[model samples]
Target: MAARTAPAQPAPAQPAPIASAVRRDTADAARWPDVARLPAAQPVRTAIARHLVGRALHRLSLLEPDGAPAGATAGPVLTLHDPQAFYLRIARHGLTGFGESYMAGEWDSNDLPGALTVLAAHADTLVPAPLRRLRPLWAAARPGQDRNTPQGARRNIHRHYDLSNDLFAAFLDPTLTYSSALFTAFPARFDSLAQAQHRKIDRLLDLARVEEGTRLLEIGTGWGELALRAAARGATVTTVTLSAEQADLARNRIRAAGLADRVEVQLRDYREVRGRYDAVVSVEMIEAVGCEYWPDYFTALRRALAPGGRIALQAITMGHQQMLNTASTHTFISKYIFPGGLIPSRRAITEHADAAGLRTTADDGYAEHYAETLRLWRQRFTTNKDAVTALGFDPVFQRMWEFYLAYCEAGFRSRYLDVRQLLLTEGTRR
Candidate 1:
């Protein structure tokens, strides 16, 4: 059996220097990957890019077809097949160029995830301090189409979750839990992933005080795993999802599990929820709610929650200043993936809950577990590459998914991202 939930403790520490100064809603890194076509590399951006690869990132090496750069350091080698083009992509597109170049096979890393962890670790420092001051000058503005309006929300969600459930199946464990799994130990055994996912759900249920006859409302029904577990525990569940694909599959899963009578999966937005539930549980769904709508998200929970009801939120979080600094500026994620999403800081979440009249009773975190989860996912994705392509994803799309997995793994492993299980109680704390 996996380890039981530990006692609640102080919130996760504000992460080390906001070097990446990026937003993560699985604290940003937690969101499913999304990609878009990008621009070509530029001369100035390439030079700046070279300096970072050569000097800044740790345990990284840049290898050119001709030879290593003069005065290059020793570390994980990033072998470049086309030197001029490779650096130009990064130079022109910055992070996007680097990823797109990788997708195009312009470069290869001896260890993809490890190479990314180097970038994730010292993300902010690579940008000269002076440029950080000029962030407003360059940060891409969030597009209106990506806003989390009811219609826009569904569109953004569809961009990622609706891509193909079969593709997700290639990598996800049997239970098909997409979010983080709370494991018993570090470097978790692959076979144990499903149980660890259960542990995570059970822990969230426990936090919300879910039990027999409890009216449980789930904001995001991710393939119905949590709803199934809750129904088995005798709690009646009303689960909602914006993705038609997810809602359809979740309903099928719920029926097959013989728990359909106990659970109802709705194709609906969290904002449109009705009725007061005994417990409110949303796992990493808050990130998709968008920072501008955070107050609305929390308020929805408060409204749906019955008197004395409890709440459990499994969220991915990042440092507060990083959240604020990057909130409005579009990054690689905002531009290509999860258009409307933004990860909140631990403080941001609690404060929002407080505003909604909920009191935080517990806050606990396990970042490394997410790292391990991503590692296993990357392994599975790599193993299933052919299966994924059979599902009709092309080479570039496959590379996009691969890079997405390694990128997230690196983020969590570097502690640049985190997942937290928070418990909240209504008035009187009963």
Candidate 2:
């Protein structure tokens, strides 16, 4: 969104230093240490995890220590340099720990997205029935303080969005847009990304019917890309964002685009928005509004919407069951990347909208495009590693971003994740 094989396979006869390679002791990188420096799992638990992981290698090969294959496999090869640490990490924290192991240099794959797609395809079957029954005892719930209260929301936004504009600039296109771009074609050339981003933004504006003299409101202004485009279409935009860094950069970008009078970038929360808007648009910000706050979020949108106004949103989606499964559980994304983010399902989106007096008028799903988008981003990110490092991000941070991008790409490729553009208007059922 985000490798090393630095750890060695310790001899069984000697004690193991499982946490040695995984520790983020860099003084410069203190901001993003690994989530909850994991303790080693009990031997029996480690053995059971090792058994399950080995059993789950249907679509990929797991290369254990000494270059031995975990099983007969046919897809990407996951090479494990520190098999003990990797297995024990999975044993301790399951999926979160698996991601931590990767961030810590425990395992790696030449084709990370391919490997991750394999895992995503087998996610349901990875843990056997008996072990699945025991998940409640082993799984950890999300931390309470990570809730999405007005104050808590700002803290969550800052953790990820405030990382650095320079850091984001290293990977994103010139527009600095972070959500899925609606590509005109698949396997699109890098040169065309900015165009694709404009295409995506323009579509949302069109769905909202933004036009000359339209009073537009954009929730989650992503560096002013949408606002600039909206202003160009003669719509006056009042965009809001919680990240101070984003607000400053967005205002500067809008001013430079000569759209300052047409677009207003506010360092404000959606809850604090006042007055009514003729058109409303939000891109990928719903994910950051935790499920618990979705009602309040949609209500705020409805309150801002004037009569005959339309609302458009681009949301990353998951299966309803999957959303329920992880609603209260902590995952790798929630832990290391976004503190309180939770992607909603399409069903949840419409239900909440309807409850807030909004009716669905259009639905468009194009997750395959998102996979390509992530692929392009990861390509640029990997190419600009030196620049990223120059920005003071640690090697582990680089790998974390690598893993995140690949992981999300795999989710889309495997149909485990989805992205949609939804159009809604105030209406009652016929």
Provide backbone clash counts, one per model: 13, 7
Q: Score residue 31 of candidate 2 by CA lDDT.
A: 51
> Per-residue CA lDDT of candidate 1, range 1-430, in tens?
2233434332222111101111211122123232223344466767876776656543234343244463364444565655666667666556766776666556666667766777788877877888778767755677878899999999999999999999889999988899999877555643388998998999899888899999999999989999999999999999999999999999999999999999999999999999999999999998888998999998999999898889999999998988988798776676656779998999899889888888888888788778778878777887777798799876666666777877877787777888888888874233
Model 2: per-residue lDDT, tens digit, 1-430? Answer: 0000112221111111112234433323455444335464589999988888866763245443444556445446676767787788898888888888888777777567877877897778878778787877888899988898999999999999999999999889999999988765556744388888888888898899999999999999878899999999899999999999999999999888898999998889999999999999999999999999999999999999999999999999999988988898899999888888899999999899989999988888887778778888888888887898899877777778888988998898888998888888997446
Give candidate 1's whole-model lDDT.
0.77
Clashing pairs in 2: 1-404, 1-405, 2-401, 2-402, 2-403, 2-404, 2-405
How well does candidate 2 score on lDDT at residue 370?
A: 80
Which stretches of candidate 2 lie above 4 Å from their native place? Answer: 1-38, 58-74
TM-score of 2: 0.90
lDDT on C-alpha atoms for all candidate structures: 0.77, 0.82
